[model samples]
Target: MANELMIFAVITALLALIFRFTSLIVNSRRNRKKAVAFFHPYTNDGGGGERVLWCAVKAIQEESPDLDCVVYTGDHDASPQSLMDRALDRFGVKLLYQPKVVHLCKRKWIEETTYPHFTMIGQSLGSVYLSWEALCKFTPLYYFDTSGYAFTYPLARVFGCKVICYTHYPTISLDMLSRVRQRSSSYNNDALIAKSVWLSRCKIIYYTLFSWMYGIVGSCAHLAMVNSSWTKAHIEQLWGIPDRIKRVYPPCDTSGLQALPLERSTETPIIISVAQFRPEKAHTLQLEAFSIAMKRLNGGKPKPKLQFVGSCRNKSDEARLQKLKNKAVELNVDGEVEFHKNLMYRDLVRLLGGAVAGIHSMTDEHFGISVVEFMAAGAIPIAHSSAGPKMDIVLDEDGQQTGFLACTIEEYSDAILRIIGMSETERLTMAAAARKRAKRFSEQRFYDDFRAAIRPIMCLPYRNSNDVISNRDTDEERVCTTLYTVCGAAISNLFEAIHKHCVRAVQRGESSSLSWLGLRRAEYGCFVKFSRLLQLNEFLYKVSKCGKIFCWSFST
Candidate 1:
C-alpha cells in the first residue's frame, strides 16, 4: 500500500511538470526576437508623441528583423494590423499594434487609475497582463517607450523586462507651472483655499510621480533614448541622472520637403503658422505678433497676409481664438490675419509650398516637429528660440548670434517685422540653411539613431544558449500573464462604469429642491473635503469602490 501511494504521488508530480512545460513551450513558440512595445494613451490624432513612437518602430523593423514593435493606444476601435500596415508603409518601417484598450482622460475613474500605471507603477496590472500575454504569444524583446503615456514605468520594470524610453520632453514645464499658479490665484478668490483646492491634483501628482519614475527607470533601464539634446539636458537637470541619455531626434520625412521649384514672388509675401491650436502652442501670441509686425511695416508698403493653419484640439483654444479675433478687430488687422484649423497634410504641404516664412510660438516646445516640417517645405523657419529649436535647428557658431529667440510679446513682434524687411537674397539664404539643418532629422537618420540606441540591449543573451530573446519573454509566464490581464481589464471597465454612475448621480441631484440631499456647491468642492461625516463616507465609498476595482484588477 505504501509503495502504491508513493507511486501515485510521483506520477501526479510528473503530470504537473509536464503541464507547466507544455505551457512554456506554447508561449515560447509565439515569442518574438528583439521586440519593444510602445505605449501611447491616445492613438487617434498623430502628434509629436505618435511621431516618435512610429519612427522607432520603423527603425527597429528595418535594422533588425529580430525586433518586433507593439503599440498600445487609446483609439479603441483602431485595427492594430491595419494601423501598423499603414504606418509601416508610409514611414518605411514594419510594425504592429497590440489590441488597443479604451482609456478616457477626463473620466475620474480612468484618469486616477490609468494615469498611475505610467507614473509610479512601471506598468498597470492590465497593461502587464496584456503585455505578458503578448510575450507568451510572440516572445518578442519587450522595450518600452515612455514618450506616450505619462505613467507606466513601475509596472513595466516589475515585469522584469528591458525598456527603452523615447523621451520627447518632460511633462511639467516650469512656465506651465507658473501660469497655473497665476490663474489659480485670480479665479479662486481665496488665494490660500484656491491654491490648496483648485491648483490641479493631476499636475502636481502626475508631474512629481513621473519625475521620480523617470529617475528610477532611467537609472536602471537597459537603455535611455531622447529626441533632442534639449530634452537630454532637461532630463539630466530635472532627474540629475548621471548616465548619458542616448539622443534620437524624431524623424521628419524630409524627402518630400526637398526644395520645390516654386518661384518666389515678392508681391504677396505669405506668413504661415502651422501648429495644433493649444494654449501651449500660443496661436493667440502668433496673431498678436503678426498684428504688431504689420503695424511696424506700415510705411504704406502692402504688408503680407498672415495665414494660421492647423487643427484646434480643445474648445478653450477655439474660444481664445475668438478673443484674439476681437483683439485683431480692436487693432484693425482682422482681415489681414486668417485662422484655418484642421488642414489636411497635403493641403498643409501645399500651403507651405507657397509661404515664404513659417512661425511657431510655443516656448520650449520639446521638439518642434512642425517647425522642421515647415523648413522641409522650403519655408524659412523663425521659431521661438528655446527648448528643442535652440539645440536642434541652428548651427552653434552662427545660431547663437543670428538665431531667433523671442522672450516677450514685444520681442516676437520685432522678430516678425525684421524677417519681413530682409532682402530676397537673405531670405532665400536663410531658408536654404533652415532646410539643410532640417535634413538631419530625416526618417532614415532617425531610424539609424534609434537602432544605435537599442543595439546594445538587443544583443543581450536569452536563457536559450544559441538563440537570443531579442523581443520578448518565455512561454509559461505569458499564459499566467494573459489570464491575469483579461481579468484585470474586465474589472477596470466595471469600476469605470460605477464611477461614471456615481458622479452622474451627484450631478443630477444638483437641481433638486432638497439642497442637502444632493451635493451642495460646497460638497462638490474637493474630494479631500466634504461637510458632513456621512457625505465624506459617501465620497470615500465612491473613491474606494473605483479604487478597489482599479487596484484589484490592476494588481493581478
Candidate 2:
C-alpha cells in the first residue's frame, strides 16, 4: 500500500509539473516586459519594512526607465494608488513609476497560527509556498524578498530567477539556540525547557538542526543585504557565506527631523517611543520602564510624560495597543501615557523634536530606525543594551556615549533619570553627539548602498522564455526539475496537513499531540527522501538531529 501511494504521488506530481510548465511558457510568451518583483507581503503596513520596500522599488525604478517593478503583497484590500499615497505620506518616498501589484491570498499560511510547535521551520516552509504562488501569478526576471523570507531563495533559483534578499534579521541564530538551552526563571524562558532537562536538550537539538536548514536556504540567495552590522554578522555566521552579506542601513528620513532646532524646554520632559505595535518591539517593556522611571522621579515637580507614537498594521496591532493602554493604567501612569497611532510624518517629527528623550525597549532589535530618527531629531536615545542600538547606533565612537543603553527596567529608569537631571549644556552636548552619529544612516546613504548592492544583480542576464524552455531539454535537467517540483509540493502538502491539524486543535481547545506527532514523522520521512534524492549527505546528517529531537519531544 505504501509503495502504491508513492507511485501515485509521483504520477500526480508529474502531471502537476506538466501543467505548471505549460502555464509558465504561456505567461512568459504573453508578458514580455523584463521586471524586478519585490516580494513583500505587507507593503501597505506603514512600518519600517514597508518603507524599505517602497524605497527599494523607487531606487530600481530610478536606475532605469526600461526596467519595470512589480510588488507582490498580501494587502488584498488596498489598491496600488492607496499604497502609493500611504508611502508618500508616511515615508516621503515618491514612486516615479507605478508598480504593478500582485495580490497573494495564501499569505496567512505563514502566520503564527499555522506553526504552533515549530514556528521557524513552519513559517519558512509556508514562505516557500507563498513565493511559489507569487511566481506563478507573475514571473519576474529578478526576485527580491524584502521581508526576510530566505526560504524562497531556492525556489527562485529553481525558476531561473536571480534572487536578492534584504534581511532585517536572521530566522534562526545562535542566540535562539542559546535561549533554548538556558533555563532561565524569566518570563521569556522557553516553557518546554523550563519543565524538563530532557525536553531542553531535545529543543536544543531541534534548534541546531533548524539552524542548519536556515543557513542552507539563506546561502541560496545571490546577494544578501542586511540592514545593520548585527544582522550582517548573524547572516554571515549562519549562512556560512562571508563577503556575500552587505550592510545596507535602512533609510531614516533624518533631514526633516534635523531641521528642527535642538533647543527644547525640559520643564516637563517628554520621553517618546516610536515603533510599530509588534510583539517584538517590547511595548509592554516600554510601559513598565516608563512606570518605573516615573516612580523614580516622584520628587521632581511636573513629572515627565511618556508618549507612544507608532503605526498599527492590523487588528492584532490595535489589540496590542489597547492592552498597552490597560497596562499603563494598571501601573497607575495612564494619565501620563499618551498613545498616538499612525501619526503623520510631519507631526512625528514635531513630537520627536520637542521630546527630551526617545526610549526603545526591544532587546536585539535588528536595526532601530526609530532610534536613529530620534537621534537625528536631537532627542537623546535610551535603547536596549544589545543588537543595533548597542553595536551600531549608540556607540561611544568619538570617546563619548552618544546615547544611553539599558538592560532592565531599573537600568532604563536610571537612564531616564540621568537625562532628566542633566543640565542644559550637558543635554545639548549628548544630543549633538547623537545627531552626528545618526547621519550615518540617512536616506541618501541608504540610497547609495542599496543601489550599489542591487546594481550587479540587475545587470545579470535575465532568463527569457526561450532560455527557460531550452534549459530543460536534457534528461537530467528535466529529472531535476521534476524532483524539485515534487519535493516542493510534498512539503507544501505536509504543511497544509499541519495547518489543518493546528486549526482543528484550536477549535477543539485541546492539544493536537497525536496529529503533531504524525505530521512530524511524515515531515521527517519527506526530508529523508528529499535529501537522498538531492545527494545532500552532509545536509542530511545535520538535519537528522531534528528527527532525534522530534522523537524526544514525542516521548516527553
Candidate 3:
C-alpha cells in the first residue's frame, strides 16, 4: 500500500510539471504582439553601437509602420518618449514615434560586478535570465538583439519569436584562443593565468568549450547582420551560417558632419581623440604619444591642444578616465590636454568643425563609424593600421591621400609631428580626401544595405509594377518592394545635447612590421581560416610618396 501511494504521488508530480510547461509555451505563443523587440539594456552607452540601435529602429519605422517597436531595457527611468528623444539627441536619429519600453528587474545579474570571476559566461547566462524576464512580460513576434548577446538566442527561440541579431563582433574568437595558448597577458587573459602553464591549459579548455557553446547559440539566429568584413568572417567561421550572415557596415553621421566646414579655426589647433574610456580602447597610448609629440615640438611651432572626448559606461570607466587625467598631470602636459565627457551632437559638431585632426588607437577595430565621422568633419585621421581603418575607412579616396595609419607610440608621435609640420594647404587637401572617403559609410548606405539584407526575412508585401524603384524614395513603403519593422517616439531630450562618436587613434609600424597583417592562412597562428583576408594586404604597402604628411588612398 505504501509503495502504491509513493508511485501515485510521483505520477501526479510529473503530470503537474508537464502541464505547467505546456501552459507557458501556449501563453507566450498566443499573447505575443506583432512587433520586433530590441534587446538592448544599456541604452545610454553613447557609443557607435547605440547609434546602430537607434538607426535600426528608424530604418524599421521608415520601411514598415504596422509593427510597433519595443525595447527590452534594464534602465528603470526609461519611457517611450525619453528613448525617442535620446535617439534624436544622442545619435541624430529621429524616430517616427515613441517605442514601447519593457523594463527588466534582473539587470544587475548582467552587470560586471555581479560576477567577479568568469564574467563573460556569467553576463551571458545573466542575459538569458534577463531575456526570460523580458519574454515572459511581453512576448513579440520578432526578437532583435542589437547588443551582441548571442546566448539569449535559444531562449528567444523557445518563445517562438523569429530571431535576428546585429553582431558587432564575435563574443569569442580564434584570437582569444591564440592569446590563451601563447600565454599573452591582456584585459581578458590575466597575468596570473599567463604565468602558470597549468592554468593556461585549463583556460584554453574553458575557452574551447565556451566557443562551442557560443557557436551553437549564435547559429540559432534566423538572420545575422554583421557590422564589418572582419566580423562577417569571424561569425561565418563560428556560426557556419554563411548564407544568412550579411555584412552591413554600421551607419555614420556623414550628412550632418559633412556640413561642417573643412577650413578650421586658426586658434589653438585641436587634435581630437574620441573613444570610450575602456581598457581595450588603449586611451593611454594616445596620451603617451601626445606627450612625446609635445616634447618634440619645435620652439617656433604653436602648442596644439589634445582633446579627449567620450562617455563613461560604469564606475570602472569613470576610474579609467580619472587615471587618464592624473596621467596627463604627471606628464606635466595637463595645460596642453583637455578632457570632454559626454558632449551633445551640436557641441560635438562645433568641436569637430574647429579640430585640425583626429586620432584613434584601438587594435582590431572592425569598422570605425567614428573614424568616418572624423573624415566627414574634415579632420585628418591617424588611425590604427589593422582591420577596419586599414582595410576600409582610412584608405585613400579618388587617388588622393586621406589619412595616416600607425601602431606604436613612436609611429603615432611621428605622425603628429608630421601633421603639425605640414602647411595648411597640405592638411586641407588630405582632409578633403578623407571627407570624400567618409561618404562610403554614410547613413543612407546603411539603410539601403540593411533593408536589402532583411527584406527576404521580414516577408513584407509585394510591390506593384507602378512602384518607384529609386533608393531615395521615402514613400517606398506604400508600394514597398521590401520593408522592415521596428520604431519609437521622441521624448523631452533626455540626453540633452550629449552625442559624440569615438575615433580611437593609433599608427602602424613600418612595412616590414606590417607583414603580419597580411599573413597566409597557415601563418595566421591559431586562426587558419583567415585565407579570405589575403587580398586585404594587397590594397597597398604604403610607400613614402612626395614626402607628404599623409598616407595615400587606401581603397580609391
Cα lDDT computed for each candidate against the true fold: 0.58, 0.78, 0.79
Q: Where's the lowest-lDDT run of ten residues in candidate 2?
A: 547-556
- Residue range 109-193, candidate 3, lDDT tens digits: 8888899888889999999999989999998888999999999988777666778999998889888899999998887889999
Tens-digit lDDT track of model 2 for 1-556: 2333354457546645655564553454336457888999887566788888888888888886688888899988767787777778888889985788899999998886677777878888999899888888887778889999988887676555677899998887777667667755333345656678888788788888888888888888888999988998889889987777789999998877888899997878999999989887888887887788787776754589899998887778889899999999899999989999988776887789899899998878889999999999999999999999988899864776789999988888889889999989999999988888889999989999999988877776654544433344655545555555565567556544554554464456443343433445455446445533643333233223222222222121
TM-scores of all models? 0.64, 0.81, 0.80
TM-score quality measure for candidate 2: 0.81
Best by lDDT: 3
User: In model 1, which runs have C-alpha deviations exceeding 4 angstroms?
Assistant: 1-34, 81-140, 146-150, 173-214, 217-220, 240-244, 312-334, 396-403, 463-556
Give per-candidate clash totals: 37, 0, 25
Error of 2 at 260 (Å): 0.9
Model number with the top TM-score? 2
RMSD of candidate 3 to true structure, Å: 23.3
lDDT-wise, the better of 1 and 3 is 3
Worst-scoring 10-residue span by lDDT in model 3: 547-556
Name the regions of candidate 3 deviating beyond 4 angstroms. 1-22, 460-556
Residue 40, candidate 3: Cα error in Å is 0.4
